[model samples]
Target: MIIVIDALNRHRFKGLLDEMHRLRARVFCDRLGWDVMVRNGREVDEFDALDPAHVVCLDADGDVVGCMRLLQTTGPHMLADVFHGLLDGEPPLRSSRIWEATRFCVDTKKLNGGKTRNSISYVTSEVMIAAFEYAREAGVLDAVAVIDPVMNRVMCRSANAPYDYLGTPKPMGKVTAMAALMDCSEERIQAIRDFADIRHDVFLTEDEAEALFRSNREAPAQRTAPPAPFPESKTEKADQMPKLPRAPHSNALQQYCYEQVLNAKSQSDVDAAQALIEALSDALGTTSAAELARLARVEAQATRKSVLVAAK
Candidate 1:
């Protein structure tokens, strides 16, 4: 069993501080060659101790495997202070639901099944579930992550997540791109499992889960990239291509989706947006897409009726 724990919030998650730090040191510093603030055989930092939205993922053996964290834009975040110049303008994070997905580390040996007994890459499902569960609880509607395109596909296939691209692949010593959104549903998750070709009967059928959620069949992912997060002052950044963010928790990801849906000018536009939201809601939670569609249609009707009444 994989466990995802939110360990950053000092007020809420103070108890797991030590354990989480050990896990990070084990994975980030010891496994991956990233320099971390480790002291006395422990990974500890002012940022790690202070950032209240850090999340950790543990494997079946109760060992830390994959981990990702959020740096909130509503406050002073790392993206703005550290890597803002790497982006186009004011970072694409302003006026948008943005948070950084930093400290993303995975036990590559675990996923690839190397000499190490404790590995994370092999059991991606548990790691993804823990990550999403924690993100939802942390109230992170969207995330800005520096992900490799190849690893992005693997992560998407692993988690069945639908994500949107933020900008061109910034080759900052590696093929990295800034991306956003990390909400995925059980159905898409199952799809990811299927893509991975895991034959374990332990996994539930995404189709069955979708039927229960009243979501539709798996639609082909929208391949096109979205508009740049900032104005294109630089030509090279403007021309580069990237994949869209996974549409996980789209409806459940209400902070971003609701505003986009509500702003649609035409009923057709509203219908399309509502349908997308329903699919996402179906996958992420127990709620059915039809239920969401019904609610949206009902709300639309009510709004229309009010408009007529106000016209009188």
Candidate 2:
């Protein structure tokens, strides 16, 4: 399945974004030998800070296995800035109706077979289909993709070959990179889908997506943030709990319940915390509160157990 993550909902899927950056590092930096900046095992650039929409392909386990980045052509994009040499001294393409697609990659380690158009393990076509569909939905008419000869052939085999090429291909590192313009229309989307035999929706429900992100956040390998300090005692913790910072959807009641769950001292307190979460979810008419409550309770219980173990 594929999920469209943009500036609006990126906060809710930080873990997924982290994984995508790491995957890019593995594919572009390590495998393709692209001279890109990689930091702390992640491939992030200024474009990521520009709030581009990402078309992410998830495996059956809801893990991000493939992704492509889309940026508005009117602004600073790869062809205009990084790969300007490929333009042959011509002005870079810039238009609101046109967008730039770059950083296209897939997790080869997760693939079960060869990189073929019909192979079930290959996700290149699926990601391409999702990208075009998403761009069309976003009102973009065309997309310019920066791809190598290998990916160009892959696009041809997938039945979604580019309609036109910009400048001539130029040697970049070990491979040649060129600009390919693609039409973001139903015809192109259908061609890729038909070639891949995908007829169903390729997106996850809100609940499934939330659960997947939560699971990724709780993974041990993702423990990059500093630990929440343990208080000397339950009373001290109650007095020292930090105030919840204001956010886009700051809910006073939800914050109160969160702090209650965090400072919970007993099984009764935990039950009350869960009940408050259910009530809040019902009042807000959102399923996310319940999921948040579940995560809070799990974290609280784990912390409590750890404290008990330390005291022993």
Candidate 3:
């Protein structure tokens, strides 16, 4: 499903946004060799801070598979500021009715296999349809997309080809970038839908989106480390711990447990930390906190072993 994330509701979907940024970093910086700033595995720029709308496609596992950014052309956009060379001597187009679309990418690695068109093409068309529908709903008349020749070809194949071009294509890094203008009309949106064979509404409800974002936040920590081996001494009695109500200060408890795990020095210390985390997880009835604690413990254990090896 596709989710429209903007500044007004960004706080509620921070996890999803983080994932989108990471995906952008992987696609643009790592794969495409784009000259974009990536910090801590997230691709973010001044445009992101300008409250642009992000149309993101989520897979069945609630992971972000594709995304496209939309910004008002009247303000500072990529074509007007960063890619002005492509415009030659012509002035950058600026209009409230026309929005700028950029940073369009998909996780091709995750969507590698399919029978007909492959997952990349499928999600790419879906994102385009969602972007056009979102722009039309927001009263936008047209969209100016700063894309490469490859993406231009993809747009043509999807039956959502641009109606006009701003200027000549100019080489930027390994790819040539050009500005293509597209109408924000139902006909364009429907064309992409039909081409992609997607007829259903590609949006998630607010509650469902929130749940997916929360899962995205907790899942990384859980997957970072294998489950800690339960110490034999505490194995039998661990299940006897009383099930308490969810703690109001669960965040604080999680932080404390994480710190404890990080400070662990030996196997016994790590075992105790794991046992404490399990106890807290049972009490709060949430695995997120325990997962974080386990991640910290695993990191500390690895560091300790490395130090021992160095000392030997």
Candidate 4:
């Protein structure tokens, strides 16, 4: 199952997020030998603080097997800050319609690469489907990623090649990296789905994912795995990352709206939460508390009328 953890719902998946970082540490720091920050066997960095969405893949046992990070190109990202040279001095792509996909990794030690349910190839494609579908749902048109040559080839082999490259590939310390741009169109998604032979929806609703993860209270420690030829950031420096803006949603009211969405027991209540969530997401990543309360009042009144009509 695929669970998309974002800033709004991250509070509930702390353990899963921690496991994802440790998995990154194993893949990037241990296997690939990429320069990154590893504290307590967990690889984390400045980009993690920017409220980026995480597309996580889980097995039947609820163990996180594969994962990838998604960040809006409108803000700071790996390509814009760290891999700027790959753009040949040209301005990095920054638009709401575009997002950056990075930190792609899988559990090689646990996920045996093959045609099984726990296979690395299947899980990798699953993560890609979730990321692309999540991006497409959010109105994103393109996704740019900083990847190594090996991953570039992997993309091609999976029937998901990049449509274009921003600049020439430059040799990093151990591997050459390039900025690859891929479209989030239906054709691209379908090609990958066909390659993986997956026909069902890979995504799981928040409630379902939560139940799965919580099902195994005595489950073993997260089974960490290798990214299987993916790329991650090199030489993480927190000082270079710009402080995130405080505008938009990140306030008490937004939190309240999210709580309502999660706790809604009726369809009208669900509709109200959906309106608040969408409006907040639509207006510049988030909105102010005043605006949120106003929207809540309007939605609540509509919901009350619907509830009364249903009772009659």
lDDT of all the models against the reference? 0.48, 0.74, 0.75, 0.77
lDDT score for residue 25 of model 1: 83
Q: State each candidate's clash count.
A: 19, 0, 0, 7
Clashes of 3: 0
Off by over 4 Å in 2: 114-122, 216-312
Which structure among the candidates has the greatest lDDT?
4
Q: lDDT by residue for model 1 over 172-261, one digit each (tens)?
A: 443354554554344554564555444332222232222222221121121132312212223342233221233343332332333334
TM for candidate 2 is 0.68
TM-scores of all predicted structures: 0.47, 0.68, 0.69, 0.71
What ranges in model 1 sit over 4 Å off?
2-19, 92-99, 109-119, 137-140, 159-162, 173-177, 180-190, 193-312
**lDDT tens per residue, model 2, 1-312:** 677889998887788899999999999899988889999999999999999999887663446788999999999999999999888999999999899999888888876565443233357778888888888987999999888888888789878889999889999888898999999999998988788777766665544455444544444332454333223235655455443333334333343445567767666677766654553353323644654566566756766786799889
**Angstrom error at residue 108, model 3:** 0.7
lDDT of 1: 0.48
The best-first sequence of candidates by lDDT reads 4, 3, 2, 1
lDDT of 1 at 142: 59
Error of 3 at 169 (Å): 1.2
Model 3, span 1-312: residue lDDT tens: 678999888888887899999999998899988888999999999989999999988764467899999999998998999999888789998999999999889898989755233388788888888898888988999999888898888789779999999889988888888889999999998888888887767776554456445544554654354433322233332233222233333343344455455556666666666655553353224665556555655655575776799899
Please give the lDDT score for candidate 3. Answer: 0.75
RMSD of 3: 14.0
Q: Who is ahead in lDDT, 3 or 4? A: 4
